[model samples]
Target: MWSYITSIFGYFFKLQEDEGREKLLIEELIDLKLELEREEFHNQNIENKVQESSQQSECFQRTGFVTHCGESYILIDGSFYFDTSACSFNLNVNDKILYLGYNNSNEELVIVRILQNEGIGWENEDDSEEQRFDVINHIIVGIVDCREDRNVFIQGGDLKFNLDDVQGTFIPIAGDWLEMQCSIQKNDEKLTDINMTQVLQVTHFRPLRTKIKSGTVTEWSGKVGIIDNQIYFDSSTFIETFIPQVGAKIKYLRLIFNAMGLPQPKIGTVEEFQGQERPIILITTVRSTESLIQQDIKYTLGFVNSPKRLNVAITRAQISMILFCNPHLLSTDSLWNEVIMNAVNNNRYMGCYFPIEEK
Candidate 1:
């Protein structure tokens, strides 16, 4: 009888334990259902916000010539300036293009796509007649005037030529002096029109030089001397320690080469120089800021962390290549670190003494 009583108490204890487990399981199921509902509510809110934002933004398409193409913005029709950071293709001045644009919630103009680019070139597809023309090389000086219609006019004395008549990749702003080589069209040995075939030089200031003999100088005052009433010379005229204050290195190089009457080297982006080989190539990796390095690595901005782009950029030179970059920033990536190590092992690495600041 005692054993039976003990067994009954044991059975009752087991039943209570099973009931406790079931209650705990039901509570856990309720908590899980609540979490799922919360997650679904959060997703629905995000979808609603996205739909509303899409409705608020306005999108449109337009056709116009690019009047000004800057580093981050492109001016179309001489009025609207759109952000070009998202554009895949490079834009140039006076390019007839069709683009898709939209205004964001902040009312900022954004460029979505570049549909077409009919660049300014002297080629007629409809004209099939082979007209023979002589190539007469002559230099002419003029002042540039950019018009609202995306037309660049060069006016000097009584001469004026349209933008289509000029041939060069350089686009000058208004009031700048342009020295170009052109061919005056001749019909039957008589000049019919003055048309510019090529642009050789462009400058902002007019070049003036005066020559004087030493014997022609009559009087001298302090550091200034007047010679033959035509020219004056001072201590500043002779450069003791010449240092050019230039904002851009490439432009300064171009100016130096043009002054010496030498052929200018081609300067273009990596994408533009693809499939083209050069004897000497200089690559400028413009990212040097410590703060931006992390962002660049995360997004693969530029050649950093991008193996294919880095390979293409480094292999373009057949003879020699000079790469300018910050080793401290680029060494964060394995690929770039390998390149740096290779250069150091080859004894070809040259480092700057001072810190490189972001430009």
Candidate 2:
């Protein structure tokens, strides 16, 4: 009897110990789970804060234009843009920098004060320009369509491209009304059919000389593919494009419209159609496309003097719609819907005769 009672007690004690061990293990598991959840919560909070801060980031953060002339860096993106002198820095290709030292200096993008990401990899901006023609720095080759009222062109080069005729700014129109001071030149002097001289001045706009493909012809649809890049004829040599990619102090800005609203243009003056093919409503007096690019800033507004001059200039916009408003006036209609038909019914002609009128 005594042995049986002792064995029963031992068994009971062993069972209690096992239960205690299991309870302890369960508590430990619960504690570990709580700790894991805490870590997750903390991480989520940090992420939320980061996202909030990023959302608050400014949309129109202005930066200075950068140019490297020898070892000296030139800040040339502003109207009164100049860097006290050519300041020297161990400038690299990519740096998310700001210029604060030159305040009230009339420079949009000024200094190297607040480097984003605390000076980490900043090469992301190099891939900004999407145009294949961007890398080709063209020189002012020749001037064309030189007459009394509109005396512009580089010289000798092809201006068969009606500045008022190109689907873009110049050829389709007279000019973009902007100017440039470019440094691109060709190696062959004999290739001097295009005469790019005059230091730098306001000139008509035209598209850069593109090596059109050999067996390609522009479809009525106005689409060109990569295979068609082999053979190129100067349509300007033939017809002409108004978007001047060559010779000028700078290229006009290709304005991208954010929405449906019209923005103003910087045409030196406004006028009626010069008997050209384009619509007359927004006809901007001929200007340089290069200079347009220089003037684009957030909230920048001006009127396009002559909507016809906007032929190539308006087409330069790659992404958004660029509304070329009147730099001087904001009339009800920025579009030339009336002129397209009026030329046909009424005897008023711009740059060239209207086919609609003939019909």
Show model 1 residue runs off by greater than 4 Å: 1-252, 352-359
lDDT of 2 by residue, 27-64 (tens): 99999999879766764454344334333222122333
Given candidate 1, what's the lDDT at residue 193? 22
Encode model 1's per-residue lDDT on 1-359: one tens digit a residue. Answer: 99999999999998999999999999999999998797667544543443343433334455667888888888877787766644555788877776655554588665545656767522233322223333222334455655435345554222334455434434567766654433322233422123332221111122211111122443355455433321223433324443222121111223223322334577766877778899999998888888887677688776677887788888899999988998877766678777777777777889854223321
TM-score of each: 0.30, 0.19
In terms of TM-score, how similar is model 2 to the real structure?
Answer: 0.19
User: What would you estimate as the lDDT of candidate 1?
Assistant: 0.53
Q: RMSD in angstroms, candidate 2?
A: 29.6
Q: lDDT score of model 2?
A: 0.32
Q: In every candidate, how many clashes are there?
A: 0, 111
Runs of candidate 2 with Cα error greater than 4 angstroms are: 58-359
lDDT of 2 at 337: 40
Number of colliding residue pairs in model 1: 0
